[model samples]
Target: MDAIDLASLLCSRLCHDLLSPVGALNNGIELLADEQDPDMRERCMELLSESARASANKLKFFRLAFGAGGGFGDEIDTREARTALEGLYGADKRIDLGWMVTDEKMAKGAVKLLLNLGMIAGDALVRGGRLDVGAEQRDGALEMVIRAEGPRILLDPKLREVIAQGHSGGEVEPRAAGAWLAHSLASQAGGSIQLNDPADEVLLIGVTLPN
Candidate 1:
């Protein structure tokens, strides 16, 4: 994909993800303005707070995953990526997170790839589940893994195709932006991605990027 098309797709994906929380924020504001009951107003305040938090978390995540976030640096603090993921996925408590990254910092490309994979895996847990993420720099390469296990996993075939392979034959869709980003980053770095076939209750993604 060309730069312009890729950017547009990423932007579309970001807007779609943020629409719900942002719309909630607007609704909360409108409700708070008209409500006379103190209790109802208090509840509105809570809704606004939650919506704002969600919006922030999603922006932070997309910033790092799809934009030039983490400032000017070859490596980014792993803590930032962890916080972004936890903030985005841990808010609802729908999916439990198990983090086992051993590196303090990793290449920015690696970090982006890792976050995108985590997001995709987490979304596959249709019935709520566990998301385990790990990364290590060894043997002169950065190796990362994201595993999702739940009662019912539903990974879209299009996403699977984009994640395992690039947009080789057809136009790229906005929903596949994240997957495309992951695949592109890996390929650009002379790396590779491995995706396990969809099974009863698990999805596994592994990436290796040479340093």
Candidate 2:
């Protein structure tokens, strides 16, 4: 697909993901306005706070992964990326993150690729699991590895195709837009993405980019 097409797909994905939390925010507001019981009103306030936090977290993640975040600098602080990932996943407490990147900073493209891969892996944990992310620079290249282990993992075959081959036979779907973007970033950086056998109990994704 062309740039415009890919952009539209990403936008659709973002909207779809945000709709639930945003809608919850709206509903909480309405309920708060109509409720007279102090306990119920306090409950609505809690709901609204959670929904607002969710919305903000998603936006922060999308900005760095899919938009021009971290300013116009060529390199981005790894700490910022960690915070973004934590906000997106830590808030829900469904997945535990173990970060192992020793570098203080990484190129913008590498940061985006890493975050996208993290998101994909975290989502695959259908039964709530552990996600371990590691990165190191060697041989004038930046390498990243993300592993997801859970009771049940359910990664879409199309996403695997996109990450491995940069396209999924035909047009890319909105849900796999992040994978597409990750593939594009890697390819643009003279990098490659590798995935372990899908049949394996754990999901492993590795990416390498020339530095």
Candidate 3:
């Protein structure tokens, strides 16, 4: 992998992760300056605290998964990965997380591959669903799979094209942007993404990350 390309990917990942909390902080401050009620002030504080915690958890998760240190050149902490996945789910989202891998450090490439796959799975469930994620170490390599099952599976054609490498940056629909990004990241990491058609009320995404 080219160092410059890797650096660019990491930069994009970091910027994406920080936007949520920063936006929340700005909104919370604006509300505080205008609202005068004591109860409302307490509510704003709570919002700020929740957003801050979410941001911190995401950063910690990404540091190990995408940063230069923490097993990038070696194996990743599987326990930490599990915790990070759960933390990203948060309390508001109604998604279930499942694990089927041994508690061991995965390679840096595998970590990045899984993170992008997780983003795809999370995005598939708009009205809420079960996100079943699993990884198996087979023949000294990792094979990851993410299954998104929900009532309604919204598949965007443009996003599908992005996953298939048929399109690049364009005025694509916003709802499918996450999956498109996931596809792009996977492509950059020397991995492949497979999205099963909307059949049997399930949207399955399978990825293979070469070690």
Per-residue lDDT tens digits of candidate 2, residues 80-198? 89999999899989899999998999888899999999999999998899999999988988889999999999999999988888874677789899999999999999999999999
Between candidates 1 and 3, name the one with more favorable lDDT.
1
TM-score for candidate 3? 0.74
- Cα RMSD to native, each candidate? 1.1, 1.1, 4.1
Candidate 3 least-lDDT 10 residues: 171-180
- Model 3, runs deviating above 4 Å: 1-20, 33-36, 64-66, 69-73, 164-192, 209-211
TM-score of each model, in listed order = 0.97, 0.97, 0.74
lDDT tens digits, residues 1-211, model 3? 2345445555676677789887998899899899999999999999999888888887876665556544346667777777777787745667777776664877665665576567556666777788777888677556778787877666566766766672465544433444455565577667787878755478777777665
- Give candidate 2 regions above 4 Å deviation: 70-72
- Candidate 1 lDDT by residue in tens digits, 1-211: 6878889999999999999999999999999989999999999999999999999999999988998984739888999999999998999999999999999988898889999999999989989999999999889888898999998999999999999888887888888999999999999999999988776467999998888
Cα lDDT listed for each candidate: 0.91, 0.91, 0.69
Cand. 2 TM to true fold: 0.97
